[model samples]
Target: MPVTSAALLLHHGRGADAHVLIAHMGGPFWARKDERAWSIPKGVVEPGEDVEAAARREFAEELGVPAPDLPVRDLGPFRYTSGKVVHVLAVEVPAALVGSPDDPASPDLTTRPGTSTAQVEWPPRSGRRIDVPEVDRAVWFALPRARPLLVLGQQPVLDALVAATTP
Candidate 1:
């Protein structure tokens, strides 16, 4: 059986004009890479657990906040080159939770980011544990802008999200 993972895709706006929230993966290996390195807030589904619940838990673990209690829709069991079957739930981040998109300094992103920090031993055995943010940062991007930056494997979720809201 392929490894299964669950993710949450938080989007906002109407129809074709939506923007989705995504995160940059953490750790030294991903530090310098930008294109094709970021990922949705997600994780492996443990035995017998509900996929949506797991997605919510992973969101909280990765971003440090409970996912807003809202209606969620399935995007896909998008299969990746790595053989991970990613099941995703998407919901529009309520307008009440966001600030103006033009203001980069605004703190009202639908979901707050970066509390599930991780620790790693850098230099491959230097014995120094370095703490890093699991999801170093997050951004809300329109599909055009996000397609180029997201991990290729997960792009289908974006397409599905757009399709779901499109007329």
Candidate 2:
């Protein structure tokens, strides 16, 4: 059976004005990519671990900060082409936690260095291993803007979020 993953979709605002927090994948492969290179902060769920807990854990690990203590709504699971089922939870963070989307250098959006790292084979199958930050940076983007930036497989989570949040 494929491993089940979980993700935390952090957003602020409502309806057409909503924005979501997404992370740019780290390492050489993703270095020059922009569109389809970002993803919601996510990770594998440990056996017997609560899905929501794992989502929050991944958010902290990937972003290098604790997820805001806000009520999270389960947006449910989305299946990736790789067969991994990522359970998604959505949280509406305060403006203080999001800062200004126009300013990428906003302190609230900045992640501390050295908190998130991943081991990867640099030149695919070359047996050369390298350590890279799991996520180079995180940014807040309005819903429409975030759509094209997110990985194709995970785009549905945005739809799920809209459906779950819309009246």
Candidate 3:
């Protein structure tokens, strides 16, 4: 199996109720702007790693914020454009916890009990590295408002999250 990891679907207090923090994906492999450009914080999981645990780790790595204590629903699995099957899990973070990953003025993103944060370089060429702080700019959304901002396949994940959370 081509292994992949999980990500947190976050909504900031300032934006729409369903606003998710979508990364600009700074690496050379990703586009600098435009649609089909954003993605929830995600990565691959190593062997023996717990799926949820890996999700928490990847969330912290990509966004700089600690994983929220919100409930998680297994969104099951989906394949990427690369044919890698990813297991999706959704977790909610309150508005207070969502913000700019590059904001040096903000408090440090705290870690969940057993989880830790990691960093990766973007642009793939600058030889300069940047930390994955959960997300670049997290914003709230109202579903319809989120359409153009989210990565192509990611919209479905948000919809699934809303459906799972809805009464």
Candidate 4:
């Protein structure tokens, strides 16, 4: 079976004013990149884990903060061209949880210091290894503004969010 993952798309507001939380992928490869360098908080679904539970767990792990206890709208599963299937769920978070789109420096969306980390071969095949945070920082961006910044494979997940919340 293809690998399955789950994500939680955290958004605030509605319509054109809506903003979603996205993390800047950590490590050297993504450090200097902006476009297509951000992603929804997600991870693989462990064996026998409930999809929703996995999404929530991944959100907390990646952000280093527990997700708010709120109802979520299922955005369903999206299969990327690489054959990875990601189950996405979205919740409208409190306005206070998201930083102002006009103020990138606002601390509202900052991740805690103890966020999850991953080990990788620093030079890609080199003998050196380094541990880096899974996501260095997270912020809020308007829906349209977030499109170009997201990983191509996950752009569809954003689309699903738009459709589900459009009404």
Candidate 5:
């Protein structure tokens, strides 16, 4: 059976050029990569857990806060090149929640990078225990701009957003 994941496509506006939230992939393998590396906050669906609940849980685990109490619209699912299906939700969060670079409370900018730890072995087989962040940081970008920044397989997820919300 193919694996399925849940993702959050947070936006702040409607139609084209909508600002979307993204997180940089963490851990060593992705550390030096940039283009086509970032991704939506998402995780695999666990047995018996509601997909939406799993999505919310993943977002909190990665971002260090509960997802804002906003209505979430299902954008449906897509299969990526890796052959995994991902169910995504489109959420429109207020700018205040993800404030500007000049704002003191901005989790994406004005403040320090958000950190979530994962235990891994350094040097692969060396068995040295090391803790690395689950995500290096997060930022918001317009859909077009986010395209080049998003993981290649997830581009369709953004396209779905544009098509669904455009008038």
Candidate 6:
């Protein structure tokens, strides 16, 4: 069975985007084009890899940052248009603990070209390269603002995450 795991990436924003939480991603197979790309840190669990363990590993390898100690609430799984089953999980992280993978210590950072640091070759024919952990930046975005930025398949997880954090 083909299965994947990912993170509900988040960051802290004090100014206008404060209450807003954001996720990180590169983009889909076709729509990718700088900033238009979005994603949560995710990857396929290797055989015998535990679910939570896969989530944590994907987060670190994809984001190039250590996984937070936040509690992960299993948000269940969802199917993608590709017919692949993706397991989702949510975690609430303090805004302060969040930072770009390139500058893992820089809180006011954005844009990390090779920060995603993971790669996957794509197109059964072209064999072009695609990066795994496909995000270069991650930031918190307020409600409604995040709608257009999230990957098509992962938005529901974000909604569930918002509900989980609210009230």
Instruction: Arrange candidates, best TM-score first.
Output: 2, 4, 5, 1, 6, 3
Per-model RMSD to reference: 4.0, 3.0, 6.0, 3.3, 3.3, 5.1
Question: Superposing every Cα of model 2 onto the true structure, what RMSD results?
Answer: 3.0
Clashing pairs in 4: none
**Best candidate, lDDT:** 2
Worst 10 residues of 4 by lDDT: 101-110
Tens digit of lDDT per residue, candidate 4, span 47-158? 9999889999998888787777889999999888889998988888778754433322223233465478899899898989998888888888898889999999998877
Model 3 Cα lDDT, one tens digit per residue, 55-149: 77777665555667677778777776766766778655554554445321122223323223336666566687764433333334466666776
Model 1 lDDT tens row, 88-153: 999776655666533222122224453666788986789989877776667777888888889999
> TM-score for all predictions?
0.83, 0.90, 0.66, 0.89, 0.85, 0.67
The residue pairs found clashing in candidate 5 are: none
Candidate 6 — number of clashing residue pairs?
9
Off by over 4 Å in 1: 100-114, 118-121, 124-131
lDDT of each: 0.79, 0.82, 0.58, 0.82, 0.78, 0.57
Span of ten consecutive residues with least summed lDDT in model 1? 101-110
Cα-based lDDT at residue 38, candidate 3? 62
Count of steric clashes across candidates, in order: 0, 0, 14, 0, 0, 9
Name the 10 consecutive residues with the lowest summed lDDT in model 5: 101-110
Give candidate 5 misplaced runs (Cα > 4 Å): 100-115, 124-129
Off by over 4 Å in 4: 99-111
Which segments of model 3 are wrong by more than 4 Å?
12-17, 28-31, 95-136
TM-score-better candidate, 3 vs 4: 4
TM-score of 5: 0.85
